[model samples]
Target: MVSRKEVAERAGVSVATVSYVLNGKPGVSEQTRQKVHAVMSELGYKPSYAARALKIKKTNHFAVLVHYLGDPFEAGILSHIEHQARRHGYFVSFQTYHPEDEERFLQEVSGRIDGVILLGQSLMPETLNGLRSAGIPVLSIMEPMQQSEWITTVDMDWEAGMTQLIRHLAEQGHRRIGFMATGIPRHPHEQRRQAFRSAMLAEGLPCEEEDVLSGGGRLEEAKSAMKHYLASEAARTCTAWIAANDLMAVGMLSACREAGLKVPGDLSIAGSENILMSEQTEPRITVLDYPRKHIAHIAVDMLVAIIENKQPRGCKMESRLLIRGSSMHE
Candidate 1:
């Protein structure tokens, strides 16, 4: 009901000043910007997004496609992305990926949003090409399953993180270390697996095929896999285990309890991503902090750059190791 004119008049500023402040344009001092914002809030003036989109040719909305919306790690990252996007005057729409509907989903979101943010979902080449042709920038929060120049990624250095975890375990006198890998194929998972093997070899430890258990990246799946591993000959020889993520590590902890194994005393455990639940579990899980806020900031900033026709670049962030109860040996 209230218009920019009313807000400008009440604030004793020009309508153009109100427009500049609302549109996030330059040339307004901090003092004037604050005053205009206060007047607009008091007057309950709402900008017309449709008119702004028509003038700027931008929807100012971004679509985030997540692999699993229920997963704590993904959900945490989404929260950060939403917060960062809001600071830039943009809104985020979240959608879970369905393999069968990839094409239709891409078609629907191609031009409706200014850009797309992918959270560990691998898009088909055809769909990616379609988005690229449509001039929609795509930024992935993790390494893509397949490499494409069109997709700018803001990813963590999984190999480095895995290597650090392995080295830490080795330093703690854990030579017979095992890895819990995800059953599903993903770029980061594969990188962690390879890094585990490489780090073991570098430390002069054995990394046999049997030492790598497929946890399937879920709590139940990881529990099942760890239970099976606990009954195997390889489990008897292994002294430490590293999971691909914190959820899987929690499952490993549950399996350890069920099997009457004491964490760090019977078998040391570590995980990646440092999800919130990691700390609540008994003998809280040690994990690599994935820097969720930093990744979100980079992804949103890169997407904005791409939308502005600027040269956007991909970056690899490093994870910090959080030493916790589970990984400390007695």
Candidate 2:
């Protein structure tokens, strides 16, 4: 392994100048920095992570917490986050969130990572407080169930998105609309469900209790729920359906097809988080685009700012309706 002294000799700069350039400090001139970097690259002199961490008191590692790895929406956001983190000279670690394992997870990650980013997990207030007390910067990519000053959050205007979707369905002459939700407690599903109700009521439409079904955030569960809905006499009145996510929307589509119902003819369908699979269905789904890449960049940027002791405010991005064949009733 070539040392910094050798890089300095090859570049004809002092050892301090080489150190300044490698650590991205301000003491070195741009020309000198470039020369030092070129020499270091030619010599393949990689800086030791342990040495840098010891000098700067930072690990350059971040952890992201998610409910599970199966959801494509979360997976897409995670991929973007990994890319952005690498650009910022940080590495990402992923962990599945379970309320039962919260304490143990926190204990293990304490002092190991510079910050934590939460991707739509419902964590206890005490857990958040513990992290805050330990001086760990946390940024949540979803609106937290419990608001805390210690944590920054980035999310979308879900109510506005739902209102737009419901109004579009109403304009297409669909008065009786049903909603499919994830049954997970204290999750963002509640926000979308409330938005659906509010939008329906705003349009003077009837949103009966029976019209709302829980699918437990799984494709099979959503299929089962849709089957049950189809068996009920009330199903005859529902002319459209909106799901909390694209996965459930796809499941509902399968159920509708199996029941001999043609999409947009018998029942129009829409969903949130326009994942890749949504476009591959027989009749592509209309959904609310959640801006996954923007959310990921904002979350990572905010967490990085917080790690540097900068006061960064939480942000909310906008969602737009992506009209497609599934919701275009003639």
Candidate 3:
């Protein structure tokens, strides 16, 4: 590796001037700074990460604690987050978070990462305290967590999205609507379930315990659960159903295909977080489009701001409902 001394020598500058330019110190003139950078690039000189970290107290790397890497929704959000992070001259890595080793995970990532972005997970008090003590800023890409005043959060309105979906079904003359959810303790999905119940009540529609299906959050699990639902007597009770996500909605569509149930004719289904596959499905899924790019932009902006001691631009957004062939206007 080429040394900073060689870069300084090639650029006709002292080592101190090269150090000033590398550190962005104010004393270096723009012309000299550009010349130093050119020489460093020409010599393929890269600063030592360890030395830089000691000098600046920053790693320029962030980690995202996410659930379900297999899910396209999370994948989409992560891709956008990476894009945004790169635009900000930062690097992003992700870990599939498990609750079992919470403290150990925190301890492992504490000093190595500059910030942590929790995607669709509730803020645990102890975890927050640990990160706080470690001096690593945190941002959650979900609804505001309770007892989490210090952390930043960004999300689309869950209740509003649910309300719009339920209202649309109601306007389409569907009274008995069911909800299919994943059997996970995801805080945002819990919020969505509450929103579904509340919206059903507000619409004066029947919200029965039998109408909700709770199982795993994978496509195959949803499909298997839905296949059994189609075989059960409870399937006759609802004319339309809303899934926790588009993947589940597609699973329902798959089940319907085997059971010979025509979408919008026998049963209507709507989904959340219009993942890329949601649109490409047969008959297509009607869904509430969560703005992944926008959410990523906000989450990255807030987390980077907090890491850099800037004011966080925290905000909540609205999801737009996309009516597709899978939904019916009866």
Top-lDDT structure, candidate number: 2
Candidate structures ordered by lDDT, highest first: 2, 1, 3
Q: What is the lDDT of residue 190 in candidate 3?
A: 68
- State how far residue 180 of model 1 sits from its true place (Å): 0.7
Candidate 1's residue-wise lDDT over 1-330, tens digit each?
Answer: 688889899999999988777655669887887787667556645455445445556888999988887788878889989999999999899987766776897668755788889998777755654454345667888764645655678888877888888888888888888888895766446667776788788768898887888998888999999998888775778899999878889999999999999997899999888998999988998899988988888889888777766655689999898889998942
**Candidate-wise lDDT, in order:** 0.80, 0.81, 0.79
Q: Candidate 1, 60: how far from true, in Å?
A: 0.7
**Better TM-score candidate (1, 2):** 2
Question: All predictions: root-mean-square deviation over Cα?
Answer: 14.2, 14.0, 13.9
What is the clash tally of candidate 3?
A: 0
Pick the TM-score winner.
2
Writing each residue's lDDT as its tens digit, candidate 2 over 180-263 gives: 989777876777888889988988999998888898777788988998889888786889999998899999998999999999
Model 3: weakest 10-residue lDDT segment is 46-55
* Model 1 clashing residue pairs (backbone): none
Task: Evaluate candidate 3 by giving its C-alpha RMSD to the native, one decimal.
Answer: 13.9
